[model samples]
Target: MVRPLLRQLLAMAIVGSTAGCLITDRVEFEDPENLPPLIESMAPPAAKVVRLDRTRSEDVSFACQVLDQNEEDTLDARAFLDFARDEAIRGVTEVVQSESDARRRSVTASFPPDLFARGCHVVEVDVIDGGAAGWDPGGQTRFRSVKEGVAKATATWFVLAYDSEGDPRADISLESCP
Candidate 1:
């Protein structure tokens, strides 16, 4: 039969041209000198429901916009607020420097809305990139054994609780902003 259909169409055209030149030595990527810190943008956004007016004192901010390709290192931004927490409240970072972008950075975190009490919180933003040597300056090891630049960002709001003609209590708390 025409020489077995011309040797099965020349063995399917040589296995479809060598199957895209199968080359594999375990190739991975993303290592432009340990690249890590890059949050881009974050604020009272990412679920957003915030409406806590226990009488309004104001001071519940959190912002982010960190980007680092190792642009001279030094960038430790942090902000956390879990709420139904056994621990996790820390928020008082304020590193600013990006009038245009020297590699970008503008992290702001301020809390004190009574440390949030009405429910559903979770707003973590961490951007660390001091060039990561792991940091163990002999303080007996204060953590961060090695996380290679580290970058984290999360947001989820909902402090609602205001029903005395203040309007903001439609009762929506399945409780899970962890």
Candidate 2:
């Protein structure tokens, strides 16, 4: 059985042996007195939509965008995205490319249909912002866009608080952008 629906991806698959499989996709928010990691996403995260062109001129497009999740009016420093693999860059699609409008704070990319025809997954999404120094590692989140099969056209966004050396940390958890 299959059902069609539209919803935002605000959680991730917690990978662990003790945690077990089939984890719920939701952020464990704390209390109101506390705070959470701001999503900093301009628009709602989507299940990669296959843009259509009846005249046969459509293309697969994705905008590597960044903004002040807490304040949409503000612009983030620099952000990047990987939509082909999670571990390595195979050159099947663009890799580690900066956004188009870094100063304005976003990157809109248009690719040939063949790229989406082959399908893709998330490698990493990172932001460089001014924390304590002039530049610092902001945070990271992963995303995956399925093209075919059961989860076709669906996107999943997950959270991770790893440092520059990839060390896990505990402090904040961002659900989705405003």
Candidate 3:
């Protein structure tokens, strides 16, 4: 099963990287179909599990292939398997996952490090009795929360313009500072 998953992942990576030069600012985790045709045989027709982490929650072997939606930007430059609670901001395990340069268009980023030189971190969620799960492109990402205050992870995007001093600060998001 693991071998098949890895093969599928590899095939996706090759297709993504070689299809063409990226020219926009988009993020994807496989292309053409953008996902495996099926995950579990019983899974719904619409569901494709692109990346999965099953078994132990405390120690995860995280790996995934990602695509740069466009060639003009670096959205794929920073990829992460972020696990957090409802509160967010805090009590989150922001693993500094790696990526190939958006210059490359697509990459297979992993915690163990390959493709890109980006860094990775050891994440330990404080909550062990419970876990959380999140997905983009729907039904792709499945993670068992090691433990965190967040009931689960949700999607939110924010960008920071110039601050009061006109200096850029990523901490100061434009979304009313929320």
Instruction: Write the residue-wise lDDT of candidate 2 on 63-152 in tens digits.
Output: 444432222222222222243333322222222323553233443444343332222223233333322132222323222221121111
lDDT of 1 by residue, 17-100 (tens): 887666679978875665766676666664556555555677767676777766767766545666335344385366677777
- Count of steric clashes across candidates, in order: 0, 2, 9
Each prediction's RMSD to truth: 14.8, 26.3, 26.1
Error of 3 at 96 (Å): 10
Candidate 2 vs candidate 3: which has greater lDDT?
Answer: 2
Off by over 4 Å in 2: 1-39, 42-58, 68-104, 118-125, 130-178
Worst 10 residues of 2 by lDDT: 146-155
| Full-model lDDT for every candidate | 0.58, 0.30, 0.28
Candidate 1 stretches greater than 4 Å from native? 1-31, 38-54, 63-67, 70-80, 83-97, 109-115, 118-123, 128-178
**Model with the higher TM-score, candidate 1 or 3:** 1
Instruction: Name model 3 segments beyond 4 Å from true.
Output: 1-58, 76-85, 89-178
TM-score of each: 0.27, 0.27, 0.19
lDDT of 3 at 19: 90
| lDDT of each residue in 95-175, candidate 3, tens digit only | 222354432222222232122122222221221112123222232332332222222212222212221333333233233
